[model samples]
Target: MKESVSHIQGVGPRAVEQLEVMGISTVEQLLEHFPFRYEDYAIRPIMEVQHDERVTVRGKVHSEPTLRYYGKNKARLTVRVLVDGLLVQAIFFNQGYLKNQIHLGDVITINGKFDRNRLMISGGTMKTSNQEVTGGLEPVYSVKGSIKITTLRKYIRQAFEQFGDQIGEILPHQLLSAYRLLNRRETLEQLHFPTDTVQLKQAKRRMIYEELLFFQLKMQMFRKLERQGEKGQQKRFNKEDLLVFMDKLPFELTGAQKQALKEILSDLTADHRMNRLLQGDVGSGKTIVAGIALYVNAKAGFQGALMVPTEILAEQHKASLKELLEPFGLRVELLSGSAKAKERREILGALKEGSVDVLIGTHALIQDGVDFHHLGLVITDEQHRFGVEQRRILRNKGLRPDVLFMTATPIPRTLAISVFGDMDVSIINEMPKGRKPVDTRWAKHDMLPRVIEFLKRELGKGHQAYVICPLIEESDKLDVQNAIDVHHQLTQVFPEFTVGLMHGRLSSDEKDCVMNEFAKNNVHILVSTTVVEVGVNVPNATVMVIYDAERFGLAQLHQLRGRVGRGQAQSYCILLADPKSDVGKERMQIMTDTNDGFELSERDLELRGPGEFFGSRQSGLPNFKVADIVEDFRVLEVARQDAAKLVNSEAFWKSNDYEKLRKKLEEQGVFQDQKLD
Candidate 1:
């Protein structure tokens, strides 16, 4: 199984290269390339098969299959076969090799989708004699360029025959019996070639359990190690001070906000260092909770720092923090890459001398020579935007400061527990009083005029609107709209109103200028990409028009729609999309059905899986090959419990049985830099 894929029969150089393109380099990798889906195509009578249904039929060809050419490189093969006294015709597109592979009087089985009176077996599995190619319950693997599912299946079968017994079991014998799971080798065998639905289900259960259990074990281990060391600062909060700060707010905090603040305040005074995650939906009043933490830290004679992703967000936080804390005589400062040299020097001096009670900035805060007098709390806004190493660099500036990570993207509770298992989580599920839900509408491309008129009406009412495009420039590959082209067309459509364009290609200074104009209402209609998905806040914006809305995931669409509806007036999110696929249309329907981010996130997971939920690079989701959080949630729960028990038990770590497991986890690199080792 450890041999190169080239060692397999029929896997020539071209085939090996194609297989490597799909990440199958070794025999083990080929075996682990599980099927994305399965179809039951056991041989059945052709007469009984319904139209438009897919089935497998066994019969003998009446005559040799012949190829007909339409062009130099285009051809089709047609074959007539007799199945249970019923005549059926099978057609294959661009497959001229069937002339040599299948002949007259050959007893072959073919799997295909049945049409009105023909079996259209385009790229179907074919087996000669009495042996079956796919057997029953055909497995369909993900394919790349020039690679067919049949080819993958053939190679995998050879691998199993050669190395099936060499596959070692990773799970403990006790667990195998306790969970009633098949051993590793048997599970692999059944998964690749299942005879019945029950066999497939059992094999899938074993694989899913193993994937989820390993991830849970790694995360729970991190959680256990976090509590073992590192004494945190004991910053006690004065009730009178908190009440005085609360009175200064223009609006009262909701019960949910108060509860989240209470939890944060409690963590600050605890002896253990606080590693907490604060999750809330867009416009759910998370800023105030973070503000309270900063104020409390300042009152305890420790300076605090808040790091944001963008410079505009840094300036916004500085302004808001100044307004909230300046009356109480707390000094606040902003540090950014664009800051003047003299201004930066002054701010750095203030930060080091403790005159700056609270400092807010982008990554500029972590620059060399920027020292803190007594940094006690570190608040990171939109935490997912920053990498693990970046967060560590900021935390290292202070002596084990209390870390509070905040994100507006609402993750499902089960996923949140598994991903951020190392940190204590506080969710603000409730919105502020008098907040109205955004009126959402899904429109087709033909309704562009109506959507345009609606935007005009909102603009006439003195409210601003936003227009988002998925792409920045026109490309030959994609047919979707681009920000540049959309900006030009929009300018022509609405000559009276100012239209602006913003995307990733623009410089930071240029983006800041464009966003500032939109925020000031200088540009009535802003055309942009996902750059505004996170930290841009404009209360006057009341209408959002997302071109090609089907291209975005549910959470992204929700976040874009959230840009509007922040003001008092009624807001509307007009989604202009006419997706041709059912999955795309279903995503659009989910967007229109609810304003709840968490609910939409779960639906997004179910529809597109976790890879799309959070992109592969930044997704906090465990990178499991077979485990799906939405479908295997029950297994995930069991794994979480088992992991917690193992991490807590003193004997498990000392036993030889878990030595290899521990080594594999160490080499995985996810836990390499953690304190657990």
Candidate 2:
């Protein structure tokens, strides 16, 4: 019990507040805050320093050289040290206080993280010989605000020491014994301050493996528990509705769509609830496929629900879905946050009265008062947008409505399984008619004038353009482009042009109006932020200019670029960066090179790795121990095998040996009971 909850040592209300600010509470949570990466600050003898090969050197402070002021207090303290006939230069930064610590010719051993820059081995944060200095790799952790590195190391070390013996081991005794995993206490202790690099690797593996195993077990167990649920949505379609709709489609359905439609159609028509995820890259006809599912439910005289992340997207989906269902004499209603009070009241009344066949909205759909007549099919666009609670709320609305979650974010298979293993998946790998590729490029701030001129020409030709600024308001430290400021700047450039602005802070009505203007091409140069990412499909918009493109993740940049290229015109995406870094260059290259969203997504994961992409932003993925998605494909395969074995029968769920496992989940409030009756 103590392992789960925390009574942290020496932490009072004020310290707790600081830890809470960093999003940590319990002891378990604190333990999960692993090192970002290790920094190898191994103290090397002065003789080990090579002419060309770079290394860290430590020796006595033989002399304190004169501090020559190099403008703006940019002065370095250089000390000569005699050690094993290798002269070492101990370079120091802004260490006015260290001057007294190191008296003239005092015996001092300096330590710094050094690397070869040309012929110079640059140093950082070196320590004097007051404390016992040891040469070894150090761990770096992610921190918040101005917390000193020394402070963080101290706190982490304390946590490890105090709670080291109490970390309740969760890996089954038999499994651990078989796998030869180090005891939980030992692993945690070794990870914080490893005896050696080898031991550190071992600790990392044990922790990562535990995380992965726990999550995989979680997803599998949840699905197992869900399978026991006798409740499921009533079937709303037969051969009649599907044949009727498919025959009317303007083009022939690709085999992939046909398969996806079959998967979705069968799930809706079946008795068990459809907890399925539909994955396809951009330009794939996910909307149309979703429309088919909705239409099936509508034709069967049952209601459906489509939940989206934003009001603009909800409204757009409402229109698009309504248009698709219109020919069948079906009624589709929009119940977004922007709806006038009277109109919203009417919509709710209609929903409860079973008059609304298919209702589409944002989070408003999950309100307690909202009711559905016979909600048989539920679909969430960009499914990762909503949390588990939100999904549960909608499913609980009407007899376990068959849920079909859709995403244009094409995740890799290993990541896909780890992140969304609980959901039965369907792939829609095909795109629609005549979707032209958007030309992409990497650029600097200097390219902005040329980019603007080009967009000006396009706008002059009656082709609308989107000039996107990343930040909505000015940030004190970052000198990046802000939406309001850019709107002002663009207005000056194109005085007569209609420019619309939209961001998160706007009221629903204001956002709707701005988005509608941009969608209808009334706003020739829409100067807004990422608020338009999931909004309407503005085909006529030919240019997409993203300012400070480096600030965006590759996946997000792709999503932004996806807004344009919808129309037949040659769409162009201009990515603007300044003082380009490595990741910056990669993001720009991904945008300019390929329209394959799946490829771009894979590349993005490769660059940033699985942690940020499949981690906390979209929580509850089976965390890897040391198995990298790119590097550890084999381990994933093994985990997949184990998952299949565990979920295959009632034995695993009923076994007494698994009771401790169940209790652990219960303690974390992870595996909760969801009644479906």
Candidate 3:
């Protein structure tokens, strides 16, 4: 199965190069490259076929085949055939040589599109009727660079003939009997050239199950290796001291926040290293809970590191955390890429000398020169923004540190289980007390005047507002509003108030300055793109006006709506959009209907599918060849349970019953290390 493509019969140097272009270098890879679709060439009676329908009919040639030369390098062959006592003309394009092979009275099977009125079949392939028809389902490979479909099919057949026996079964016998799945070799054969629809379905089930089971097994192994031999720090902190720290806050802790903190505390005090994910909607007070955990770690005489995606968020966290923990003599410092050289040097020195209790930074925290004194706790904000390798680098800085991942994007439970199956999840669903859900409304473009009046009413109450646009600059392709144009229009509408414009094109320092002014209430109205969707916290903002709301996804609209409604005042989110498609209108209606991020995420997944849910890059979803995380969720659940049971069983790992599965996983580099991407 590992043999090169060149080893296959009829595959020479040119064929191997063409196969490699499609990412098929080995025989196993070639076999795994399943067809995207299939074509059925079953024989049908001419009277039963509809006009312009592709059909296959067996006919006897009645007229001699004639070849004609048309424009440059073009030729056509026409032959008359009798099917069901009705004469029909069969036309083949660019196959002039077929005239020599086809003759009068030759019984041939013609498969092509039939024109009933003209009694003609164009672009048809003819084969002798006496030859067996491999016609139930014909696999169609996505070809490129001079590779014909017939050539590809023939090469695949040759590959199976030469090395079919090497494709051994990877699933255990019990699983095979339990699931009623076909053996691996038979599964591949049926997938490539299925005899019937029933076999095709069964073969597909086997493949999907195998892919999902292996993936879940890899996740289970990763979880096992995370705590197999490592000993984590058992932090000791006084309960009275922790309660006193919480009581000093101006606002009381919500029940959900307390629960999440309790879970973190359990992981922190356990002997094994903790890998936990803290998920909550926007404005759920997740930061305060994380702050409490950091405080406990500091009291235990170990340093803590908090990493965010942007410098503005790091600064905001440093300010808030310092205010919360500094009174107890626990120091908090900020480190970012834009920090001055002297300040960076001093902070690094302090971090190494055990002076800084909590260090908050951006990607700069994972750089080479940054070292910690006794790092025991690590927290990454917006965990999806960093890749798996980046998180691993930070964790390697400490000896089995208890890691906590925080995200404002509330993932659905199904996706959470599939992607973060190895980590313990803590969700804070309850919003803090006194916080009211934002009043959502949808309006068309003609309602701009009324929307302006509403915005003026909110601003009249001395509250800030945010006007979001979809694009930063004008685009010739898109008909939506841009930030620059929207900024100009809003500045004219609200001449008395200060309107600040910000976008991705702005420098980091410029963005920070704009955000700082907005936070200080110096900027009355901020016009920006989606750059503010993540971590800009302004409590006094009361109204959010999004132009071209239909252009954004439901999850994104929800995030922008979260930018406001942070303060004690009643907040409103006005969606100014006139969607043309039903899906777009449904999205607008869904936004106005509920404020639950989890529900919105599920709907978004259903509307856009798993690939576009969180986007392919930041989604952290494994790219399975056969299984879909959304459609095959039930199969995934079953596979996850089975893999967990097998990993926990002592006999499965030690006995010969599972040696093939173990060796296959090792060959795929699953057991070589604990790294997961």
Candidate 4:
């Protein structure tokens, strides 16, 4: 089964190259390349076929075939045929050679669209009585670049014939019997050439269960490896000191914040290293909760590190955290890439000598030459921005330190479990007291004057505004407003106020400069793209006007809306859109209805589907061949529970019942560096 695809009969060198292009270099890979859809080519009677319906009909050729040449090497072949004693015309495109083979009174079958009114079948394939049609649920693969469907089908058939007996079952016999599922051999056979609908459904169910079970088992094993025998620092901090620190804060901690802090503190005191994800909506006071955790870590006489995605966010956090923790005699330092050479050297020295209790920076914290004397806690803000490898490198910088990943994007509970199953999760759902929900409204493009008037009134009160556009420049395809155009128009409309432009095309320093101007209130209105969606905090910006709001996903729209409502003044979010589709209209309506990020995320998942919900890049979801995280969530839950149970059973690991699973996991390298003990 591991043999190269060239070993298969009729697969020449050129065919091997094409199969390799599709990532099928081995017999096993070729077998696993399942078809995306199937075509039903069951023969049907012409009298029973409806108008403009796809039907496969058998007929006898009554008229001679005529070939006509059209523009640019295109040809049309038309022939009259008699089906069910009714005369009908069958048309084929670019198959001029069929004219020489098809003849009068030849029994033929065609599969294509049947026009009942004209008694015509266009875009049809014809087969004579001597040729085989192999009709009934024909598999259709996603082919690319000269790989014909018939050629792929032939190759797959030959592969099954040669390697069918070599296939082995990965799932245990007990599971197959308990689930009443077919064995691996039968599942593959039925998936490729299913005999009936029932068999196809059963085959798909088995594959989905197997894929999800393997994924969940991997996650469970990772959790075990991180926690088993991994000793974490038992911080010896005084409770009175923490209480005194909390009391000094200007605002009281929300209930949700307190709950999250309690969880973190419990993890810090435990003997096992902590790997947790702290998630919340924007302005939900998650930063404060993280600040408290950092302080506790500092009080334990250990160093702490906070890594963010951008220099602007790092700078913002440095200021706020210093104001919060500096008074308590915990030194907080900033180490960004743009820091001067001498300043960077000083910060590095302080970090290594234990002078910097809490160091905050961008990705520079993970680079070389930055060593820690007693790094106890590692926290990453906008956790999704950093990849898995980056986080692992930072974790290796210390001795099994406690890690807390913070993200302002509120993920739905279902997605959170599937993506972050290896770690504990804590959520902060409450906003700080005295923070009002931003008033949301939806308007049409014709209502721009009213929105501008509202913006003028808000700016008159010394408040700032943000105008978000979908595109940076004019697009030949999309007719929506662009940032540059909007900036110029707004500048002319408000001559007394300053308008700034910022987009992805700008340099990092330029972006920081623009953001700084906005933060200082020098730029009254900042017209930009979604570059400001993450962690650029400007409290004075109370108004958010999103142009072409329907072009964005619900989660993104929610994040953009969160930019405002940070200040004491009442903030407003205005959506300018005239959606033509029902889903787009529903999206605008949903945004105006609720301000809860979690609720919006759930709806967003439903509206955009799981693939587009978080985008595969940021979702961290496994790419399953057969399992859909959303449609097969029930199966996923069952698989997760079973995986947890199996990993916890010590006797099972030592028993014969585990040999097959152990072998399979070993083949997947799941237990490479893992200790079963």
Q: Report, for every candidate in turn, its global Cα lDDT versus the true structure.
A: 0.85, 0.74, 0.89, 0.89
Clashes of 3: 0
1-677: candidate 2 lDDT, tens digit per residue: 13432365666666666667777777767776667666555666544555554355655566775455576867676666654555556667766556667766666655553333332234555566676565676666777765556666676677777776667776667667766778787887777677888888788767666665656666766776776666676675568667877888888877788899899887777777788889887777888889988888887777889999887788778778877888888888998776799998898899888888889988889997898877788888887778878877897798767888888878876667655667788887667757677888777898778888888789888999887888998998888999999988888889889888888898877988887887777888888788777636888988889899889888888888888888778988888887358777767776778888878778887888645765454644434534554455445555665665765756556887666666777775546742211
Tens digit per residue, CA lDDT, model 4, 593-658:
999888888888789864566565464467777788777877888888888888888844787777
Pitting candidate 1 against candidate 2, the one with the higher lDDT is 1
Give lDDT tens digits, candidate 1, residues 404-495: 99999988888776666667889998889999999999999899998888888888899998999999999888999999999999999999
Give the poorly placed runs of model 1, Cα more than 4 Å off: 1-41, 47-54, 60-96, 103-106, 113-119, 128-134, 137-170, 192-197, 475-479, 609-611, 617-620, 654-677
Whole-model lDDT, candidate 4?
A: 0.89
Worst 10 residues of 4 by lDDT: 668-677
Question: Which pairs, if any, clash in model 1?
Answer: none
* Each candidate structure's count of clashing pairs: 0, 5, 0, 0
Better of 1 and 4 by lDDT: 4
Scored by Cα lDDT, where does model 2 land?
0.74
| Ranking of all candidate structures by their TM-score, best first | 4, 3, 1, 2
- Report how far residue 104 has shifted in candidate 2, in Å: 3.3
Flag regions of model 2 displaced more than 4 Å. 1-42, 45-56, 65-96, 118-127, 134-170, 177-180, 340-342, 443-449, 473-476, 614-616, 619-637, 649-663, 669-671, 674-677
